[model samples]
Target: MDTLRIQRMNMGSGLQNASGTDKAQPVGDLGVWHVPQYMPGYPTAATIWPRVVIIQCEGDVCPGYEVTPELGRGEYLFFLPTRK
Candidate 1:
């Protein structure tokens, strides 16, 4: 199976939720990177460029979501590969 990847990125500070709550779920002393939902025509477990917000730290793997790059810090891409 193809695996999704994610790299920690510094957003200059902590991230917040829509309800004005701080996403400070420390993963090894790091805050959470709250990803945006509602990317039409794709699985909830994946993300694409320009629509996804880049943030720091390898956050907790969301139930139906996944990160990309599987490496160092920067903008990460999330996508699901088709099986043949």
Candidate 2:
């Protein structure tokens, strides 16, 4: 339920990424999958109030779309862009 809401928010948020694209949006239509703490490359143990998605997940640290330069490199949010 919350994940669905997040997907909607991701679309309506109308944000972009470093390359001037909405690629940070979720990769699933109705699912927002975050990196689990038990996962090998868990980015952070902080709260989930973040705006980001895995841009490239082939590394130890997944690069995410930084909603702002100051949000740091933590890519915790995951969802598919509803606009697509």
Candidate 3:
């Protein structure tokens, strides 16, 4: 048997106005970082589980629809035993 999990996480950031010339960058600094507090319409969860962690940043690219990382944000999807 195999176990799979799908979770939607919002890091909390507003969409920049289409007119702005300034490009948006990742919302973090060198070392530690924080997720945005308020996101309209979406109710903030009282208890936040910090188990999920971002492992690495592969790279950035423009993929027709939008600019997204080539490998995307790496994080723990779930745990599964190896099939033998």
Candidate 4:
């Protein structure tokens, strides 16, 4: 998906009245460069760019969703992946 398409998403919010299993559509992958994980001040050549995937969540998986990433959510609830 394109940048505009990603921006148009709901930013990870659970769907009300959602039943059955949530379906996760693989939107795409994002490559972040030198993201400051710890030490929330500034990245002084110590931060590492981690690998993560972006998924367009559907149903209940939208809100408070979590996959098996090595580093978990980046201090945010949104921008997470869902199960297939």
Candidate 5:
């Protein structure tokens, strides 16, 4: 059976290569899939929250949406792929 696996590693701001060389490594499987950002509006402006959906699995494995609570400021959420 084929499935999508999400693996996480601690970069620690010191990602190194096999030869111990300093290198900038990606945070996720695909090297930082998406970066969510927000900026507050002016005094008369309103706050805009962010909503993101990431399909971690291939084909129809994923549930097509997030099952966890909404993401807060600077917070991240991970979901497991669904199996038939």
Candidate 6:
């Protein structure tokens, strides 16, 4: 027998919404998948609150969109992960 759990994260509110292309609209289709987390050498804890996904679009108008003068090319996404 196998146990299954369903969890949904809405990326259309708070800080996420403030800086997203589709503030009023949600991105992608809603679906669920089975994922597993593994610990290598140490014990750790995980939480289920905030999750992020990357979104990228290309066009002539916004060819290689640059957010900052120093930063070249714009790779937009729902969440930016921190380096561990």
TM-score of each: 0.18, 0.21, 0.19, 0.24, 0.22, 0.16
The sequence of per-residue lDDT tens digits that candidate 3 reaches over residues 1-84 is 112121223322223323212222332332322222223333354443332223222122111122123423322111111222
Which scores higher on TM-score, 2 or 4?
4
**C-alpha displacement of 16 in model 6, angstroms?**
28
lDDT rank order: 2, 4, 5, 1, 3, 6
- For all candidates in order, the CA lDDT equals 0.29, 0.34, 0.24, 0.33, 0.31, 0.24
Q: List the residue pairs that clash in candidate 5.
A: none
For model 4, the run of ten residues with the poorest summed lDDT: 31-40
Off by over 4 Å in 2: 1-44, 48-75
Please write out the lDDT profile of model 6 over residues 1-84, one tens digit for every residue: 022221222322222213322212223343221222111233334432333432232321110111232422222223221222
Task: Quantify how close model 6 is to the true structure by its C-alpha RMSD in Å.
Answer: 17.0
Q: Candidate 2 residues 1-84, lDDT tens each?
A: 232222112222223211222223234554454432212244675655544443433322233332444544444444332331
For every model shown, the clashing-pair count is 6, 2, 0, 0, 0, 0
Candidate 1 stretches greater than 4 Å from native: 1-18, 29-41, 44-84
Per-residue lDDT of 1-84 in model 1, one digit per residue for the tens?
Answer: 112223223322223222222332222222222333322233444333332333333332222333333332333323222222
Q: How displaced is residue 16 in candidate 1, in Å?
A: 11
Specify the poorest-scoring 10-residue window by lDDT in model 2.
4-13
Q: Give the residue spans of candidate 5 off by over 4 A.
A: 1-61, 66-74
The 10 consecutive residues of candidate 1 with the worst lDDT sum are 12-21
TM-score, prediction 3: 0.19
The better candidate by lDDT, 5 or 6, is 5
* lDDT score for residue 31 of model 2: 46
RMSD of each: 13.9, 12.4, 13.7, 10.0, 12.6, 17.0
* Top lDDT hit: 2
TM-score of candidate 5 to 2 decimals: 0.22
Model 4 TM-score?
0.24
